[model samples]
Target: MIKRIFAALLCAMAAACLSGCAEQTPPPEEHTGTRIALSMASRDQFLVTVETSVLEHAAKNQVDCTVWDAGNDYVVQMQHVKDAREQGYDALIVNEVSPSLTRGILREAEDMPVVFVNREPEMSALTVGKNAYVGSDDSEPGRFQAAWLNDYAEEKGLEHLNIVYLTGIEGQASTIARRESLMDHLKVDHDFVYDSTAQFDRAKAQVQVGMLIEAGRSFDAIVAQNDEMAIGAAMAMQAAGKELCPILGIDGTIAGCQGIRDGMLSFTVRQPGDEQGRAAVDAALALIAGESLDTVSGVTLGEDELSLMIPYEPVDAENVEEYIS
Candidate 1:
């Protein structure tokens, strides 16, 4: 009965893929009896969306899933992994609080199949056949942001500009990759007039940018590591009655898409939360069943064979409406 149900679930997933659904449809009822545990780094806005999708897909596939939130604490996250392993979970999906802790978490998991989502871990920690990662290529979003900014500058006839840069939590893999790649790919001559870490918080970003405004710092553009900080910068400029400049961000979140529609954000790189969440669940199940990760639909394995990458799309005014809902 379980095998039949799982087979039907795979067919449903394949059908959704064929139909070109951005968010894959979940299978009907739960009868597979597969149990998995999702250990999350935090319940941040973007991650909450991923969690919702995971729960939805788990329900549809009849997998028993338990979610543990670490409140952004690596120690707490490690405890969750230990719990999952000791409790006899069929598989474990982790959104690590820190990529540096991947090795420790893997040690706790022992021989259990593990899938790391969103937060990219070090390559050394991942063994292709044993564990894998499912998320976007962190560097791509930065490249997209840089390309858009370059074109914007060219169109404006600006040879050089003062830019404000907002970064996520310091030392995080995504923060490093996004910032470094943006700097590497940017073609325009620019100076970072105001550069600081907003820790991926909207309020923090607003406060920081507000201070810059108070100090009378001039900048031609704002680039944030994620949509939350980007939206916060927009709010700060509006509150101070300052004319908005081209604000660019990653994470094509709902609010980010809306910001583009409202002319608050110039553009964002859309990271499909729903797709990543669904892929994480599917990967976990496959590993538990002793199946290959390549068999998973709607995701491509990274060259390392330890990563299942979801592509990122650029979203701007020209196509923002399509992502608004």
Candidate 2:
């Protein structure tokens, strides 16, 4: 009888122990969301458009994002990165103030995933696991510019060409790639009459091109690294009462689209800022979620698989309307 009673007591204790163990076991971890930091080089028109797109997509993807404008200053940009890290950002999207300063940025960013956008850094600085670049193939826009000019010349049965090239900020990846591609390809059959940096500024391009026109420098074509400068060059030409030649540009901005519609710009390559912005956000989220870039749509790893190049399209009278909408 005492043994039976002891057995009943042991069963009750075992049941109690099992219930206590069940209560003590932890549930699976719940994922709240991701926080992102976007540091911009400046609030320029193109970047502003990109910023808006990023915000739109971030909201759609349930990622919290904050943007800090670096005002084209390297020191300020570095500070922004540090702040983002201290604030516990899951990832960073930096439009570097200068491409050369990326080394410092990576050092300051430490463990955070960085998606460099618009202006790209050196390939050596990029790494597949932690850091990546997001931009149009820096070479494609310039190549398209040259290719379109070539086709136009061929179609019109034109022979000689005089070109004025307005460059972006010196040493920038985009500026270097675009200028090199255009000059190398165009020089095969054309003369570069005036080639200089307009610092990616409309007013600067206007002043420089105005001076070129005033000096009676004759050119049959003008190519600017970006649409803002291209539009500015066209404005300078209009101000001088000179007939507009084939004014080509890249970054098919809204202004550039209007320029094509208004017959001020001959053609522009659409760099798809919206797509780039969305890609950056998506890539950031994917990194936070520990997902592979290969599984992500609208993104591709570079040759070394360390960067992402968004596709670019040539926009002109033929296909400008689709982009405008």
- Per TM-score, the best of the predicted structures is 1
Q: For model 2, how does the per-residue alpha-carbon lDDT over 212-242 read when each residue is reduced to its tens digit?
A: 9899889888988899999999999999998
Candidate 1, residue 224: the lDDT equals 97
* Candidate 1: residue 65 Cα off by (Å): 1.1
Could you give candidate 1's per-residue lDDT for residues 279-301 as a string of tens digits? 99999988888888998889998
Question: All candidates' TM-scores?
Answer: 0.89, 0.87
lDDT measured at residue 182 in model 1 versus the true structure, 0 to 100: 93
The residue pairs in collision within model 2 are none
Distance from true location, Cα of 134 in model 1, Å: 0.2
Error of 2 at 244 (Å): 1.2
Query: In model 2, which regions exceed 4 Å deviation?
Result: 1-33
